[model samples]
Target: MRATLIYGLGDVRVEDVPDPVIESPTDAVIRVVLSCICGGDLHSYHSWTDSNPKRMGHEVIGVVEDTGADVRRLKKGDLVLAPFTYQDGTCSFCRAGHTTSCLHGGYWSRFDGGQGEAVRIPLADTSLFRLPVGGDSELLPSLLTLADVYGTGFHAAVKGGVTEGSRVTVIGDGAVGLLAVLSAQQLGAEQIILMGRHCARTDLGRTFGATDVVAERGAEGVTRVRELTDGLGTEIVLEAVGHMPAYEQAIGVARSDGTIARVGVPQYEQAPVGNASLFGRNITLTGGVAHVAGYVERLMPAILDGTVNPGLVFDRTIGLDEMAAGYRAMDARESLKVLLRP
Candidate 1:
């Protein structure tokens, strides 16, 4: 089997690796049909300085090839969506709809990377969502997004309290941020402001639901948002960039008593969250890694019916052997998202 491995920063390779086999009674093996590169993967792709190699990729959709003795929810030939993270459905956190924080859960990379020909999934019954049989091929890309990006964007919107007629500002124009705009609109936000300078991405943001695009940065960006909001910042600010600057911008542009939902993977070791920055303004700072498994089922219908097309984020598709170039294209901002066909 050929799998993607990150040997160091900016060094992704496709190499032959041993095929994964069912290792536990609750595990299942599946042939990966489609997978994708995620923005979070870039963090490791850019900064990983470890000497040891690591498996890459998490967003995956595949067909079950074999099931463990204890697995009953899925079987051979069943198409499944494997959320970026795996969780035991019986855990308290999972029952409470926070599957990302499940007591016995971990990322797909822990067992088998998604950017591979096939993978071994542990806790198959609880970790994988079997897609409806006979779904169209056109829906595959959208269904693939449900495994991560779309669900993540939906999580950001929900956590930020986006509702009918709400004013929303999304800081970051990456795939997740772009989808956040779409999610905000679907949730009924009347005014969506996207803060990003990239022409292509902001254009997609507008199509997604952004009523305004602010191409400014730092304080100027905050000022632009304030101007659009009539001096008070937006009601909900989504920080999707996952950096200190993006976080600060989100904090700066959020109105007093507003909420900032940060779904970006934080790259900083520490963030300032003192009274001067948060408590004094009565601002609610929330958001973390999305509970993708929890949101997938709810969002699947929307994708199936074509109400949302978050899959548009995949600007390019490449064979598994071209994954390194795929990473380069994404890192260079030449592409929004890259889908890999194994």
Candidate 2:
């Protein structure tokens, strides 16, 4: 089997690797159906340190080819979505909705990642969500988004307290941030504002329920948010860009008593949070690595019903062999997301 191997920054190679087999009674082997690149993958694609040759992706969906004896919830020939983090499902934290931090939390890049032909899933019963057999086949890419991006987006809005008629602003227009906008609207937000500059993305955001679009990039962007909210800032702000500037901007655009949900994956060595700047403002800071496990079931119905096409974020699609082009398209921002078929 061929798997994507990361030899260094900006370096990805499709090398023949040994096939994976069940190594645990709780494991299952999946024939990857579809996979895609994520913003997090870009971190490894551009970073010098994350360049260590290793398996590279954490988002994917597939068909079960085999399952271990302990895997009672799934069987061979089932279609399923694999959570990026594997959990036992009975752990205290898993029951508490923190699957990302499960007692047995681990990363998987099937074969090398979901980008491969097959993958061995650990903690099978707990980590895999089997999709209905007769469901919409065209929905796989969108359903695939639920494996990570959609789940993360839902977490961003839920953490930010998006309730019926709440005023919300999503700080990043990347796939996750864009989906956050959709999640907010789906939850009944009356006024949804999207902060972004790209024409295609801003258009997509509007389709997803962005009532207003702010094209400004920096401090000017902050001013726009304040102006939109009558200087009170938005009631709920989602920090989806995992950068210092994006972090501060989320804080800057939020109202004095607003809540800022930080969902962006940080790559920086240090982040500066000023005490005085946030102290007197009554701003509530929330959000972190998303609890994706809590979202799969909650989002499955909506996605299966076509209430959300998170797959719209996938601006391009390619074969697993075109992995390099997929990376280039995302890195150039020429595409918002890319789906890979093995």
Candidate 3:
């Protein structure tokens, strides 16, 4: 099997690797139907210093080829989408609805990789969601988005307390951020503001429900967000960019007593948060690794029925062998999102 491996910063390759086999009684082997490059994957690819080759994908939709003896919720031929973090449905956290932080689930960082031709899914019953047998092909891309990007975006909005008539500001314009724009609008935000410099992405955001686009760089961006909200700042701010600057922008644009959901995968080990600033502003902050379980299930029906189409964010598509090119396209910001057929 050919899988994507990240050897070091600015280095990614497709190399032949042994095919994954069922290793647990609860395991299921899936043949990758479609996968894609994520902005988070690019962050890890660019930041690591060591030449450690590991599997690279976390978002995937595939057909079940085999299943472990104990797997009952899925069988061969079922097409499923899985959250990047695997979980045992029986775990206390999972039962409580925090599948991503399931005590029995492996920390996402410990996994070998998800960007490969095939993968062994552990805890199949808990992690996989089977799509309708005759689901819409046009909806596959949006369903795939639920596996991660859209899920994260929805989490950002929901976590930030977005609701009907709320003023919302999305702090990034990447795929997740674009989806956040859509999620916010779908959730009934009265006004949605997106902050980014890229014309293409900002345009996409507008199409996805962003009511206002702010192209001003850095601090000016925060000003524009405040201006859109009549100087009160937005009621809810979604921080989808996992970088220091984006985090600051989220915090800056959030109104006093408002909420900021930080969904961006943080790039640095230590990010300074000023208690005094937060204290003075009295802003509520909530977010972490997204709780994708319930959100995926809730959003799937909308996607399948075409109520929401997150697939519009996919600007490019390629084959498994063109994995490196996919990464480059994302790194250069030439593509909003890349979908690969395996």
Assess every candidate by TM-score. 0.98, 0.96, 0.95
Model 3 lDDT-worst window of ten: 106-115
Candidate 3 residues lying further than 4 Å off, grouped into runs, are 107-109, 133-136
CA lDDT scores, all candidates in order? 0.91, 0.85, 0.84
Query: Model 2 clash tally?
Result: 3
Order by lDDT, highest first: 1, 2, 3
What is the C-alpha RMSD, rounded to one decimal, of candidate 1? 1.1
Candidate 1: tens digits of C-alpha lDDT, residues 1-342: 999999998999989999988888999888999999999889889888879778998988899998889998898999999988878999899999999999998887865799999998889999999988453488888889988888888899999999999999999999999999999999999999999999999999999999999999999999999999989999899889899999999988999999999999888878878898988999998999999899988888888787888888888999998999999999999999999998
TM-score of 2: 0.96
Best-to-worst ranking by TM-score: 1, 2, 3
Q: Clash pairs of candidate 2? A: 109-112, 109-113, 110-113
For residues 13-78, write the lDDT of model 2, one tens digit per residue: 777878888998999999888888898888878774652576766787888998888889898888
